[model samples]
Target: MVTSNDLLIKQRSVIKFLAAEGCSAANIHAKMKTVYGEMCISDCAVRKWVRIFKGEDPREIILRDRKRSGSPLSALVTAHQEKVDCMIRANRRVKQKEIANAVGISKERVHHIITTVLGYLKVSARWVPRQLTVEMKAQRKDMCTQLLELSTVCPRMY
Candidate 1:
Protein backbone atom coordinates (compact mmCIF):
# COMPACT_ATOMS: atom_id res chain seq x y z
CA MET A 1 0.00 0.00 0.00
CA VAL A 2 1.25 3.46 -0.83
CA THR A 3 1.53 5.36 2.44
CA SER A 4 -0.38 8.62 2.76
CA ASN A 5 2.90 10.48 3.34
CA ASP A 6 4.36 9.20 0.06
CA LEU A 7 1.15 10.21 -1.72
CA LEU A 8 1.35 13.69 -0.14
CA ILE A 9 4.93 14.26 -1.30
CA LYS A 10 3.96 13.15 -4.81
CA GLN A 11 0.94 15.49 -4.74
CA ARG A 12 3.10 18.42 -3.64
CA SER A 13 5.55 17.95 -6.51
CA VAL A 14 2.70 17.57 -9.03
CA ILE A 15 1.05 20.70 -7.67
CA LYS A 16 4.31 22.65 -7.79
CA PHE A 17 4.95 21.59 -11.41
CA LEU A 18 1.39 22.59 -12.38
CA ALA A 19 1.70 25.94 -10.62
CA ALA A 20 4.97 26.57 -12.44
CA GLU A 21 3.09 26.19 -15.73
CA GLY A 22 1.04 29.27 -14.69
CA CYS A 23 -2.05 27.30 -13.76
CA SER A 24 -4.31 29.07 -11.22
CA ALA A 25 -4.77 27.37 -7.86
CA ALA A 26 -8.39 26.45 -8.58
CA ASN A 27 -7.49 25.17 -12.02
CA ILE A 28 -4.63 23.12 -10.60
CA HIS A 29 -6.86 21.65 -7.91
CA ALA A 30 -9.46 20.72 -10.46
CA LYS A 31 -6.90 19.13 -12.78
CA MET A 32 -5.23 17.10 -10.02
CA LYS A 33 -8.55 15.91 -8.63
CA THR A 34 -9.64 14.96 -12.13
CA VAL A 35 -6.37 13.25 -13.09
CA TYR A 36 -5.38 11.59 -9.80
CA GLY A 37 -8.93 11.09 -8.49
CA GLU A 38 -8.49 10.10 -4.80
CA MET A 39 -5.35 12.14 -4.09
CA CYS A 40 -6.90 15.33 -2.77
CA ILE A 41 -4.46 18.23 -2.67
CA SER A 42 -5.77 20.71 -0.19
CA ASP A 43 -6.97 24.11 -1.48
CA CYS A 44 -5.06 25.79 1.34
CA ALA A 45 -1.79 24.13 0.23
CA VAL A 46 -2.39 25.06 -3.40
CA ARG A 47 -3.12 28.67 -2.44
CA LYS A 48 -0.05 28.82 -0.24
CA TRP A 49 2.18 27.47 -3.03
CA VAL A 50 0.59 29.90 -5.49
CA ARG A 51 1.42 32.81 -3.20
CA ILE A 52 4.96 31.51 -2.77
CA PHE A 53 5.42 31.11 -6.54
CA LYS A 54 4.15 34.65 -7.08
CA GLY A 55 6.96 35.96 -4.88
CA GLU A 56 9.52 34.06 -6.94
CA ASP A 57 10.27 34.58 -10.63
CA PRO A 58 7.59 32.79 -12.62
CA ARG A 59 10.20 31.20 -14.87
CA GLU A 60 11.98 29.63 -11.90
CA ILE A 61 9.44 27.50 -10.08
CA ILE A 62 11.50 24.90 -8.21
CA LEU A 63 9.61 21.83 -6.99
CA ARG A 64 11.50 21.79 -3.69
CA ASP A 65 11.55 24.44 -0.99
CA ARG A 66 14.05 27.25 -1.59
CA LYS A 67 16.49 28.58 0.96
CA ARG A 68 16.05 32.04 2.48
CA SER A 69 18.62 34.84 2.09
CA GLY A 70 20.20 34.54 5.55
CA SER A 71 19.49 35.07 9.20
CA PRO A 72 18.23 38.53 10.23
CA LEU A 73 20.62 41.19 11.48
CA SER A 74 20.07 40.45 15.17
CA ALA A 75 20.27 36.70 14.63
CA LEU A 76 23.33 36.91 12.34
CA VAL A 77 25.53 38.43 15.01
CA THR A 78 27.21 35.67 17.08
CA ALA A 79 26.83 37.90 20.15
CA HIS A 80 23.03 37.94 19.74
CA GLN A 81 22.78 34.15 20.17
CA GLU A 82 23.84 34.53 23.79
CA LYS A 83 21.42 37.42 24.21
CA VAL A 84 18.58 35.33 22.82
CA ASP A 85 19.52 32.48 25.15
CA CYS A 86 19.45 34.83 28.13
CA MET A 87 16.09 36.29 27.07
CA ILE A 88 14.52 32.86 26.76
CA ARG A 89 15.99 31.80 30.12
CA ALA A 90 14.68 34.99 31.74
CA ASN A 91 11.20 34.53 30.28
CA ARG A 92 10.42 30.97 29.24
CA ARG A 93 6.95 32.01 28.16
CA VAL A 94 8.10 34.86 25.94
CA LYS A 95 6.44 35.25 22.53
CA GLN A 96 8.50 34.95 19.32
CA LYS A 97 7.59 38.51 18.33
CA GLU A 98 8.58 39.77 21.78
CA ILE A 99 11.91 38.02 21.45
CA ALA A 100 12.37 39.45 17.95
CA ASN A 101 11.71 42.96 19.19
CA ALA A 102 14.09 42.55 22.10
CA VAL A 103 16.79 40.89 20.01
CA GLY A 104 16.33 43.13 16.95
CA ILE A 105 15.59 40.17 14.63
CA SER A 106 12.66 38.65 12.83
CA LYS A 107 10.28 36.22 14.57
CA GLU A 108 11.54 33.51 12.18
CA ARG A 109 15.09 33.88 13.46
CA VAL A 110 13.94 33.68 17.05
CA HIS A 111 12.10 30.50 16.12
CA HIS A 112 15.21 29.11 14.40
CA ILE A 113 17.44 29.80 17.39
CA ILE A 114 14.93 28.38 19.82
CA THR A 115 14.49 25.18 17.86
CA THR A 116 17.97 24.73 16.35
CA VAL A 117 20.25 26.17 18.99
CA LEU A 118 18.38 26.48 22.30
CA GLY A 119 16.62 23.10 21.67
CA TYR A 120 13.37 24.29 23.22
CA LEU A 121 9.79 24.18 22.10
CA LYS A 122 6.86 26.40 23.07
CA VAL A 123 4.06 24.33 24.53
CA SER A 124 1.09 25.87 26.36
CA ALA A 125 2.90 29.22 26.47
CA ARG A 126 6.01 27.76 28.07
CA TRP A 127 9.35 26.73 26.63
CA VAL A 128 9.96 23.03 27.19
CA PRO A 129 12.49 20.41 26.11
CA ARG A 130 11.82 19.39 22.50
CA GLN A 131 12.97 15.79 22.63
CA LEU A 132 12.18 13.52 25.55
CA THR A 133 14.93 11.35 27.09
CA VAL A 134 15.14 7.73 25.92
CA GLU A 135 13.93 6.49 29.32
CA MET A 136 10.98 8.87 29.27
CA LYS A 137 10.10 7.75 25.75
CA ALA A 138 10.15 4.13 26.86
CA GLN A 139 7.92 4.91 29.86
CA ARG A 140 5.47 6.80 27.62
CA LYS A 141 5.44 3.86 25.24
CA ASP A 142 4.63 1.48 28.12
CA MET A 143 1.83 3.78 29.31
CA CYS A 144 0.42 3.84 25.77
CA THR A 145 0.57 0.05 25.64
CA GLN A 146 -1.41 -0.20 28.90
CA LEU A 147 -3.93 2.34 27.59
CA LEU A 148 -4.34 0.33 24.38
CA GLU A 149 -4.93 -2.85 26.37
CA LEU A 150 -7.50 -1.11 28.60
CA SER A 151 -9.33 0.27 25.55
CA THR A 152 -9.43 -3.21 23.99
CA VAL A 153 -10.94 -4.66 27.19
CA CYS A 154 -13.38 -1.85 28.05
CA PRO A 155 -16.65 -1.29 26.19
CA ARG A 156 -17.02 2.13 24.58
CA MET A 157 -19.11 4.39 26.82
CA TYR A 158 -20.00 6.58 23.87
Candidate 2:
Protein backbone atom coordinates (compact mmCIF):
# COMPACT_ATOMS: atom_id res chain seq x y z
CA MET A 1 0.00 0.00 0.00
CA VAL A 2 1.22 3.48 -0.85
CA THR A 3 1.43 5.48 2.35
CA SER A 4 0.48 9.15 2.61
CA ASN A 5 4.15 9.99 3.24
CA ASP A 6 5.14 8.26 0.02
CA LEU A 7 2.46 10.17 -1.88
CA LEU A 8 3.70 13.43 -0.38
CA ILE A 9 7.24 12.65 -1.47
CA LYS A 10 5.97 11.90 -5.00
CA GLN A 11 4.17 15.22 -5.12
CA ARG A 12 7.22 17.06 -3.77
CA SER A 13 9.40 15.46 -6.44
CA VAL A 14 6.93 16.49 -9.13
CA ILE A 15 6.86 20.03 -7.74
CA LYS A 16 10.64 20.22 -7.79
CA PHE A 17 10.80 18.94 -11.39
CA LEU A 18 8.14 21.36 -12.59
CA ALA A 19 9.70 24.25 -10.75
CA ALA A 20 13.03 23.42 -12.40
CA GLU A 21 11.26 23.61 -15.77
CA GLY A 22 10.12 27.17 -14.84
CA CYS A 23 6.42 26.18 -14.53
CA SER A 24 4.57 28.58 -12.18
CA ALA A 25 3.12 27.26 -8.89
CA ALA A 26 -0.44 27.95 -10.15
CA ASN A 27 0.15 25.86 -13.25
CA ILE A 28 1.76 23.04 -11.26
CA HIS A 29 -1.16 22.96 -8.82
CA ALA A 30 -3.66 22.85 -11.69
CA LYS A 31 -1.81 19.92 -13.30
CA MET A 32 -1.55 18.05 -9.99
CA LYS A 33 -5.24 18.61 -9.24
CA THR A 34 -6.17 16.91 -12.53
CA VAL A 35 -3.93 13.92 -11.74
CA TYR A 36 -4.47 13.49 -8.00
CA GLY A 37 -8.13 14.67 -7.85
CA GLU A 38 -9.42 14.42 -4.26
CA MET A 39 -6.05 13.19 -3.02
CA CYS A 40 -4.25 16.27 -4.25
CA ILE A 41 -2.64 18.47 -1.64
CA SER A 42 -3.94 21.99 -1.08
CA ASP A 43 -2.87 24.84 -3.40
CA CYS A 44 -1.19 26.52 -0.45
CA ALA A 45 0.92 23.44 0.18
CA VAL A 46 1.91 23.28 -3.51
CA ARG A 47 2.91 26.93 -3.44
CA LYS A 48 4.95 26.38 -0.28
CA TRP A 49 6.88 23.53 -1.85
CA VAL A 50 7.36 25.51 -5.05
CA ARG A 51 8.79 28.44 -3.13
CA ILE A 52 11.07 26.12 -1.15
CA PHE A 53 12.34 24.44 -4.31
CA LYS A 54 12.83 27.69 -6.22
CA GLY A 55 14.38 29.72 -3.39
CA GLU A 56 16.64 27.11 -1.79
CA ASP A 57 20.09 26.08 -2.97
CA PRO A 58 19.87 23.46 -5.75
CA ARG A 59 21.99 20.99 -3.71
CA GLU A 60 19.70 21.32 -0.62
CA ILE A 61 16.39 20.36 -2.22
CA ILE A 62 15.10 17.63 0.15
CA LEU A 63 12.30 15.45 -1.21
CA ARG A 64 11.71 13.57 2.04
CA ASP A 65 10.03 14.89 5.16
CA ARG A 66 12.36 16.13 7.91
CA LYS A 67 12.30 14.60 11.32
CA ARG A 68 10.44 16.69 13.90
CA SER A 69 11.65 17.37 17.42
CA GLY A 70 9.32 15.69 19.92
CA SER A 71 8.83 12.65 22.04
CA PRO A 72 8.41 9.47 20.00
CA LEU A 73 4.94 8.05 19.27
CA SER A 74 5.65 4.82 21.17
CA ALA A 75 7.99 3.65 23.94
CA LEU A 76 7.43 -0.09 23.46
CA VAL A 77 11.06 -1.09 23.00
CA THR A 78 12.36 -4.42 24.30
CA ALA A 79 14.22 -2.69 27.14
CA HIS A 80 11.00 -1.12 28.38
CA GLN A 81 9.18 -4.46 28.05
CA GLU A 82 11.88 -6.21 29.98
CA LYS A 83 11.83 -3.60 32.70
CA VAL A 84 8.06 -3.87 33.01
CA ASP A 85 8.22 -7.66 33.18
CA CYS A 86 10.90 -7.52 35.86
CA MET A 87 8.94 -5.00 37.91
CA ILE A 88 5.79 -7.14 37.70
CA ARG A 89 7.63 -10.33 38.59
CA ALA A 90 9.29 -8.62 41.53
CA ASN A 91 5.90 -7.44 42.82
CA ARG A 92 2.76 -8.86 41.27
CA ARG A 93 0.57 -6.33 43.10
CA VAL A 94 2.57 -3.35 41.85
CA LYS A 95 0.43 -0.60 40.34
CA GLN A 96 0.62 0.28 36.65
CA LYS A 97 1.34 3.92 37.41
CA GLU A 98 4.32 2.94 39.54
CA ILE A 99 5.65 0.75 36.77
CA ALA A 100 5.16 3.51 34.22
CA ASN A 101 7.05 6.00 36.39
CA ALA A 102 9.91 3.60 37.00
CA VAL A 103 10.10 2.50 33.40
CA GLY A 104 9.70 6.03 31.98
CA ILE A 105 6.60 5.23 29.95
CA SER A 106 2.85 5.62 30.17
CA LYS A 107 0.51 3.59 32.39
CA GLU A 108 -1.45 2.42 29.36
CA ARG A 109 1.75 1.12 27.75
CA VAL A 110 2.67 -0.71 30.93
CA HIS A 111 -0.79 -2.28 31.02
CA HIS A 112 -0.45 -3.27 27.40
CA ILE A 113 2.94 -4.86 28.05
CA ILE A 114 1.66 -6.74 31.07
CA THR A 115 -1.61 -8.01 29.62
CA THR A 116 -0.89 -8.35 25.91
CA VAL A 117 2.86 -8.89 25.66
CA LEU A 118 3.49 -10.75 28.91
CA GLY A 119 0.17 -12.65 28.88
CA TYR A 120 -0.76 -11.62 32.39
CA LEU A 121 -4.15 -10.83 33.92
CA LYS A 122 -5.25 -8.96 37.03
CA VAL A 123 -6.76 -11.54 39.40
CA SER A 124 -7.73 -10.73 43.00
CA ALA A 125 -5.76 -7.46 42.88
CA ARG A 126 -2.62 -9.25 41.67
CA TRP A 127 -1.04 -9.96 38.33
CA VAL A 128 -1.15 -13.62 37.37
CA PRO A 129 -0.20 -15.53 34.28
CA ARG A 130 -3.18 -15.95 31.99
CA GLN A 131 -2.25 -19.56 31.23
CA LEU A 132 -1.62 -22.09 33.97
CA THR A 133 1.70 -23.91 34.08
CA VAL A 134 1.86 -27.70 33.69
CA GLU A 135 2.31 -28.23 37.42
CA MET A 136 -0.70 -26.07 38.25
CA LYS A 137 -2.84 -27.99 35.75
CA ALA A 138 -1.74 -31.30 37.21
CA GLN A 139 -2.40 -30.11 40.76
CA ARG A 140 -5.89 -28.98 39.83
CA LYS A 141 -6.61 -32.30 38.09
CA ASP A 142 -5.41 -34.29 41.09
CA MET A 143 -7.58 -32.25 43.48
CA CYS A 144 -10.62 -32.75 41.30
CA THR A 145 -9.99 -36.50 41.11
CA GLN A 146 -9.66 -36.70 44.90
CA LEU A 147 -12.92 -34.77 45.41
CA LEU A 148 -14.71 -37.03 42.90
CA GLU A 149 -13.49 -40.19 44.70
CA LEU A 150 -14.55 -38.81 48.07
CA SER A 151 -18.00 -37.87 46.75
CA THR A 152 -18.47 -41.35 45.30
CA VAL A 153 -17.36 -43.09 48.53
CA CYS A 154 -19.68 -40.88 50.63
CA PRO A 155 -22.72 -40.21 48.48
CA ARG A 156 -24.71 -38.69 51.39
CA MET A 157 -22.04 -35.92 51.81
CA TYR A 158 -22.22 -34.72 48.21
Best by lDDT: 2
Against the true structure, candidate 1 has what lDDT? 0.78
Runs in model 1 deviating more than 4 A are 1-76, 131-158
Regions more than 4 Å wrong, model 2: 56-61, 71-74, 97-109, 131-158
Clashing pairs in 2: none
Tell me each candidate's TM-score.
0.36, 0.67
What does candidate 2 score on TM? 0.67
Q: Write the per-residue lDDT of candidate 1 for residues 9-43, one digit (tens) a residue.
A: 67778777877788998998888788778678777
lDDT of each: 0.78, 0.89
Q: Which candidate leads in TM-score?
A: 2
Considering summed lDDT, which 10 consecutive residues are worst modelled in model 2?
A: 56-65
Error of 1 at 2 (Å): 35
